[model samples]
Target chain A: MKNNILIAALLFAAFPLLSNTLVVCPDCPVNTIAKGIALANPCDTVLVQSGTYYENNIEINKDLTLIGEGMPVVDGKEQGEIFTVENKYFYIEGFRIQNVGRSYVEDRAGIRIRKSTQFTIRNNEFDEAFFAIYLQNSSKGLIEGNHISAHSLEEANSGNAIHAWYCSYLEIANNVVKGNRDGIYLEFVDNSLIHNNLSQDNIRYGLHFMFSDDDSYYDNEFVDNGAGVAVMYSKNIVMQRNVFRDNWGAASYGLLLKDIFDSEIFHNRFNQNTVGIFMETSNRLKIQQNEFSENGWAVKMSGGNQTNILSKNNFLHNTFNLSVHSAGTDNVFSSNYWSDYAGYDLDKDGVGDVPHRPMKLFSYVVSSTPEAMVLLRSLFIDLLNFSEKVSPIFTPENVIDETPLMTPLPVFGKV
Target chain B: MFKIFKYSFFDLIRSRWTYIYAGFYFLFTLGMLMLSSDLSKVVISSMNVVLILCPLIATMFGVMYYYNSREFTELLLSQPIKRTSIFTGQFLGLATSLSVSLLVGAGIPFLMFGVFGSDQAGNFLVLLFNGVVLSFIFAAISFFIALKNEDKIKGFGLAILVWLLLAVVYDGLLLLGLSWFRDYPLEKASLIASVLNPIDLSRVMLLLKLDISALMSLTGAVYRKFLGSGVGMAISVAVLLIWTIIPTLGIRRVCLRRDF
Candidate 1:
């Protein structure tokens, strides 16, 4: 196996030497990208010069490198898919692809990779694309430094910027996505890493996951989207150092987890979202060291969430710190700093002597009857909450932080 | 009437209670401003104080002033002055003095913080406007209650009751009603109910401006659409005006017919 691996590496090193470079420009003999790809062989390079190419359905079936000089424009004219790759060892970079047409039946994309392995799509710009960079059943691929944007009016008509379906071992990093239906979408995808991406003003979630597992996302900013990031039916996900900000709307949330199990969420900053981190039916999750400031509700836990350990988080000045619909017995909340925790810290141990109950009676009332939220900040409701805090009655009894921090934890580095 | 109004206004302005009220607000606002640098947050905290304190203080002061100056009011009644003008002048004087106390008390600290230059200027102005309106409404209501009740204990008891009812009990009942009839659409019902109560009206109006982000929820969208608009402002202001006018009219009706 060692000899075979050495021979494969040696063949890859020699293959580039035998490859030829094909140029595609307006004045060249090979003018169109389709013509350039058709003339190129395996392990060859197609160098597309800077010019407007009104092309669509450019298929790549060989192991080739397509490099665009000076960021050439590939306008699909709202026609169909562009640069559909079906083979392995493919690489494309530095092209501005735009205007892939929308269809109710077909999922048209700027670059669609299907059943391909060891591919790299880097430094690309996509505008008005229905689906910007789509991967299906592809493995060991890198999607980096791509700027994807679309004016998505509604959920039905718009598509995602980076969509991965049934894919594995993908690295999506340093991309900026805005105004799309979803910034990044993963369905049935596993073992992926998404980082350093800024997704804002999307019509739907910034990042959406469905049935994906073992994926980690960090250092991403999701701002002013319909919602921030949503992970559903996923397991073993690690989300860290992401900033979810200003996602304000009727149903907007910073991070939404549904039916997710064994996930670790830490060091994230949730600021000014309507609902910061909304969890439903998620179990055994470890949430620690996150900072939640000025959100509507710092964390809203719906029914069926169990065994979740939330510790060392800073809940700073959110209107409602926590709203638990039905408290699970095994869920543990410890050592979290609550700005509204009015308990005294005696003995100077850095923890409050009294247990901090994050769930307020008004939040309980609001969860049951949403219209009662209009009474927020009223003197009557303050009295009611105070009385309820003195004795656990309306709000769930189990949703209490046993060791509440006296001051906000210095968890996040910078936001 | 103008002479009486001027006398009462100056008399209350010189009173130590008025100075104490204004001083309390000034110190509280200044302390809040010093505590937090966020002007919007300061405005929100002041909003709660204004909503609760303005009406209560106005109610207490109105009943106390009317009861304390009863002999002087009788001497004025023995003069050639019209009764309507006398009561109307007293009511106007009391409301204006209370409003001045609120404006000076809350306005100075905000001005020291340069609230006019900040983005929270609009919310601050709304806070002051709601406080002033509540003062007028509650003062008029209490004045009318004092005129109707001959007994001092009963008048003070009734005025405090009115304040308690509007400030606290109304919201409790509204919440109970909202939660009870949650199956039905209570948006219009709740809006109308809040509009009917001047305190709730002021609270809702100020809340829509301050906590708009938190209120931008499912039902809050409906509220934001209504209360965040010019029409809603006009309606709330009109309701507050009606709240003030009805009580003043009741005071006038009692002043003309009362045996005192």
Candidate 2:
């Protein structure tokens, strides 16, 4: 039976890349995948046609492109990691791979490319594979246009869709990642371009990056994920023109910038997330021209990080413009259009005459105790906010926009 | 004791219907494993499915195995043998065969997943293994129901109902209680549920082993905080053994007192 072959093939990964197209029909040639790889040559492409191909622990150690023809179904049958690719200049596209065994220690995946350079994985679909397109200790890779969905249902059950670990010069774009713990994740990936991806409906963040430095991302859409994008402990990153929307939860954010330094966050659209941007211990960041709309909390500053500029932005329809746990020092909030700002323009200038203190006391309470969300729409919340604004007690005193702009914005650019 | 164990084991194996039930059970398990997506939930949910199957298989086989082997048992009783040994052999045999079939049917597929270090893997193994344990437990319980309850059909009904109550209903009522008292530090409520039912303990043990202790929320926290991993593992194994022993001992007591 096909199940027997699948069970047997799980220990190996070679599904054969011969002549760029491989067909794995029932009683077809080569039920055991690694065996077929011995006959395969470099620069050759393997086409896995529409059937269940059982690949038993085949290591691709040559230059080849593996493409699945006619939506071939590759079942690892819950045995182990299905495909292990170690080839440079390898391109794998268009296969439905499922039931790859989950392992935390192994960092397993449907298609795991380790120490591989300049590989392109596109148009492939993964179902419940722990890490769909996992690049570990690999450099100069392109993981694009892959559709990956894993059902975790429990935290221990799922892994990231696209996980890049210790990989540099990676281009992860145009991928649709969903259902896994995190979609399109990069850990210790350096100098990469992550853009134009649709990552959503995941258990955790749509896109998460940590210890990844000098990476620039723009024009990607993150929607309906548990949390939005999280950039942590990385330096000199550029995040521009991305649409962060519909991530609504108690602990969710449009973008979470934590322990990061010297990152440029510009022209990003943060909508309907719990908090637009949560910055904790991030310093020297240039925050410019971003649009924050319909979010629960626009911005929350927990640590007293310094020298981060917030200017030329639009904050509209968020319940609270900002929440600060500490008197976060040396962060500028100037010339930003706040929709909640009722201050007048006395000199007929575009700028407001009166300075606006954005943070409210209720936000402070909510920051301290999450249970205070039940008191959100009450008069007590309003009274506390008004009292704090009148005298500045609960929130950060120095965190205020000196020149709150009167007009909405010149033109909110596409992000 | 050894003689009785031998006699029971053969009796259950000889019952042709037991083999048929086991075959069908294996097929059903395979069908579910292939068809279901969101495999983790499918695993936990299948516990109830196993519950329904285990008791039915156990009770029917247990009742028929004991009833049909009455003549053979009487023949052994006429020989140089103690009544307790005859009873023990029957109990041991039925429980052993049921456990073996359950393991063969479901346990190997789960292990074949090779998903070590995942909560899903641990959860699934426990779930399927619990089926094996429950088979033995329920088989022993059925012996008492068949002998002491007078009517064979009534004993079968009660056995089925008791299995349902233990496997499913108790947890439902406990959840309702936890949900009702939300803000009352109900984190410890999970431990309460575990202590109340051993299946819940098995489920929790599997989840905890997966290294995903964070998302378990209110009750899981209590378990992690109070009962350490060692304690949890010990408790799970103990519960399974307890489930097996209680009915076997109960059946022996019933058998000793009953006059044929």
Candidate 3:
């Protein structure tokens, strides 16, 4: 009975000793923020106030909430790697960051996650760092509501804004990425949902997904990038209701598809780019209910594409309707409204009488010799295209839209 | 004299720290390529750091050596020799020390051609140019400082300011130009603007060798595409030469004029 009373007294004494909050102030006892964090437990919250703290290479390796109050900023001190989070089930939110070192040897970031799970990073800002948020060799992460900007002196010197490599099960939503090498980049990522992001004006593509398969991206706007988006070497992808607009360059496009297969591109807008949709060696894509307008070329399909479906789409006011490198047959160009379609709808069902042969001979010649684009809109090229269309000598005979839609579908404008 | 070169060489021979640094860099380059799934990105990235750090190190070393060699320089000047010969010897000695050591250090990783290793090795030629030009640029600057000032910190400050202004701050100025002159094809003007600094030129030429000229397309795309062929490449080489020779000759003239 005496020993039990002593143990109860000890427990009572320790009640007021444990504190769950960390406060960062200039007049505080400790000067090193990292040292203070080291003394904290997993459930503690680190509340840093507004001051430009100069610290370098911080590793966040616990399940704690790092909350910045009143715009507290953590500088890399112009040294390197501001915060590296390799912890599971953590939340890092509400800070401003700047001046991460540029090391070509390592994949450094304002926040780098490795082999972690169920993490959330939101409501932060980063500037002049190599990469804003770097996700590598990790899974099941949520990156949302971060505004990131970067300044790269040279392209070779710059890194991506948000980069995912060899990672899966990501939920990236509602972020604004601007002025980095690429706004958002993914390579070999899978099972991800990218939605509601505004990525624009980056040095390269706004969103670059290469070999990232089984992912779905919807309701994102990619505008005024060096290139819009480069989708290459992937399968089982679904791109729906996204807006690819205003990304213009000499060789830029709304989407550059190379070696892609078995994807569904639905209800997207391709607007005001050099080429609306450029495809090469892509096959078996179901392009449905999409709108292509005011682009240089509505669809520039090279010779290597096969077994694709162009159904229930609208092509309005593009300079050239559909430019093909080869007259690939049985590609199924049906139920799409072409604004330039001039055939009569005599049956009163709003369908054209003549089948539309989209592959003009001049488009093929233009593909072979790009300099012949200068000869476009000329009388000789028109006569040549018409003569070839009448007998179908140069273009494939069966590559035609059997029944063209007379009226465009109501789906339009940045869907 | 050969004695001066020999003495200068032996003077800073205790920089075994350079050996350790070289080993670290070699390991870094190789380790980066191995860890990276995209090997070309590693090389491209390594090239970027190589240019920036290499030039800074060369420049810093030259400035530090000139300052530290006060007594040594005084001893050589006490002899009945011309000041130009001493400066030339120092310049050659500095260039040889930094260039040869960097080549051996940076070249060892690419001895085995990993993925994109051949292109990387091809780009080693450019790296070599960067190292050579950087060393020469510093050597010329070192000579001017070695002639002009007796203080080391002042010379270092001048050199640092110059490199910073040329590489880092110049882009900000270009950005300012873009904002100021919104109507003109200022990007096209930027191509000519890059000619003002050789560091930018080296980066441009190396990127051109990579064959994705979209970056140049905005600024000097017309100039690079039109003359970037044979004659254009040759002219770029000439421009690189101008960056080196003009500065070196100015140092040579200063060495002739100064009564060290």
lDDT (tens digit, per residue) of candidate 3 on B14-90: 47756665776778777876776554456556666665766677677777777777677788888898787787777
Listed in order, the DockQ scores are 0.63, 0.01, 0.01
Candidate number of the best lDDT: 1
Docking quality tier of model 3: incorrect
TM-score of chain A of each: 0.95, 0.89, 0.91
Candidate closer to the true structure by DockQ (higher is better), 1 or 2? 1
Per-residue lDDT of A248-284 in model 1, one digit per residue for the tens? 8778999999999999998999999999999999999
lDDT per model vs. reference: 0.92, 0.74, 0.75
Off by over 4 Å in 3: A1-19, A30-32, A389-391, A413-415, B1-260
| TM-score of each model's chain B | 0.98, 0.79, 0.87
Show the lowest summed lDDT stretch of 10 residues, model 1 chain A.
A406-415
DockQ for candidate 1: 0.63
TM-score of each: 0.95, 0.58, 0.59
Show model 1 residue runs off by greater than 4 Å. Answer: A1-17, B211-216
Worst 10 residues of 2 chain A by lDDT: A371-380
Q: Give residue B26's lDDT in candidate 1 (0 to 100).
A: 97
Task: Enumerate residue pairs that collide in model 3.
Answer: B227-B232
